[model samples]
Target: MESKQTIEAVLQGKIALVTGGTKGIGKAIVKRLEQAGATVIVTARNQPNEPDATYSFIAADLSRAEEVNKVANAIHEQFGRIDILINNMGANTFPGGGFNTLTDEHWNQALQVNLLSSVRLDKALLPKMLEQKSGVIIHISSTSGQFPIWESTMAYSVAKSALNTYSKALATEVASKGVRVVTVSPGLNKTEAMTTFLEDYAQQAHITVEEMTSKLFERVGGVPIGRMAEPEETAELVYFLVSPAASYITGANLIIDGGNFPVVK
Candidate 1:
């Protein structure tokens, strides 16, 4: 058995970059990687509510190509190379009400945030990883990529599906070069954003938050675990994937959905 200190130092001297790491799942991931002794660099549109001095922070809205380049270049200049890349930035801010409610702008924004941002960042940073012949990249996708709720998550789901495919293709291309790429499709996470969304909807519906949560479960064909996942739990999985323990795993979409996905992939 490994001592806690030894386990915590597993990633000592490693450099990790996590996007949209200011809050929620992304924030949790930053903490996890830092705890494991990795020097973590975080990028997001805004500063974290509770900032930590241990890791460096860069502010950038990754949807824009220039911003993506800036982040990549900054990391290269500061760290020279990254040992782990966690593409944890994503959102489903489009309007609900199925296809007709969505427009070209909405679709484009969805793709830009959920898919293209990672593509651009990967393109910028992957050369260093490949040149070094060692690295891990984790794409934080959503279970909606596989199980879409047409009425509400149409555009968001489409974007995540594209990300899923892209992650697999990138993994296959880079695995032989000693780099591992993996996609993590998390189910419903009890993040602050999710809580706010539920509260707003519940208020509008004149229903309790608990009732709205139950409705969400039913709409998604039920989460057998009977609850949403905590951000820390999902972060732990991301940590494991980037660690040496999961060296043989690549080109795989690992779902941490608490049994919410209806189909067996």
Candidate 2:
């Protein structure tokens, strides 16, 4: 059976830019935004044909500040304005044996991809949003940021925690201007990142990836919902945060972890 819809086309007259919006959660958010009648611009290092009629595509390497500035300039030249920006492009490294085995390069790379990339993009687009005083900036964060699964992903977790902090600070700076900044931190999302993690766990456990994945979930505290969240489930949250229903909300990092995050309140 199909799941019931949780968000409607409340963004009917908006324009959105979703970075890393090719596949996985980014793709899901792009589709949902298009369905809601928002004209979305999906960006990636390599551009793919737009999937939604109301959607467009641009190519830029977000890790490079010059490319990010170019992307912002292009959007200004072409779209004139952006009402929402979803900073979702991210990458993680394979587990590096143990905590002490990690290196400075690893930390720097993680920081660039996970946190600074979003910051650079936000800096470029934020001015216009401030001018308009009516835009939403949603950052895709991770539960590991708060939970700190350091035995496995120290760099990634730390970088995301930094991103969460940036989101809060940026939100405070712009909230009074009518521009909202918020984050959605998801856990064990069944995307490419999760697939690679399972593969690595399989190697370490000397078991099949599927078996290792099952056991890994059990070790982390079984997902109370009994399954990894689908791309659509995460996308629905992105949709709401950008919609009017969540208008008064800003600077909050909403976690969707299938009960995986052990924090209380």
TM-score of 2: 0.92
Q: What is candidate 1's lDDT per residue for 44-161, written digit by digit as tens?
A: 9997777446789999999999999999889989999999999999998888888899999999999999999999999999999999999999999999898888877899999999
Off by more than 4 A, model 1 = none
TM-score of each: 0.97, 0.92
Clashing pairs for predicted structure model 1, backbone only: none
Model 2: how far is 143 from its true place, Å?
A: 0.3
- In candidate 2, stretches whose alpha carbon ends up further than 4 angstroms from where it belongs are 1-8, 49-54
Model 2 over residues 41-112: C-alpha lDDT tens digits? 989987675543457888888888998998899999998989999999887774555678788788888898
The local distance difference test score of model 2 is 0.87
Error of 2 at 242 (Å): 0.5
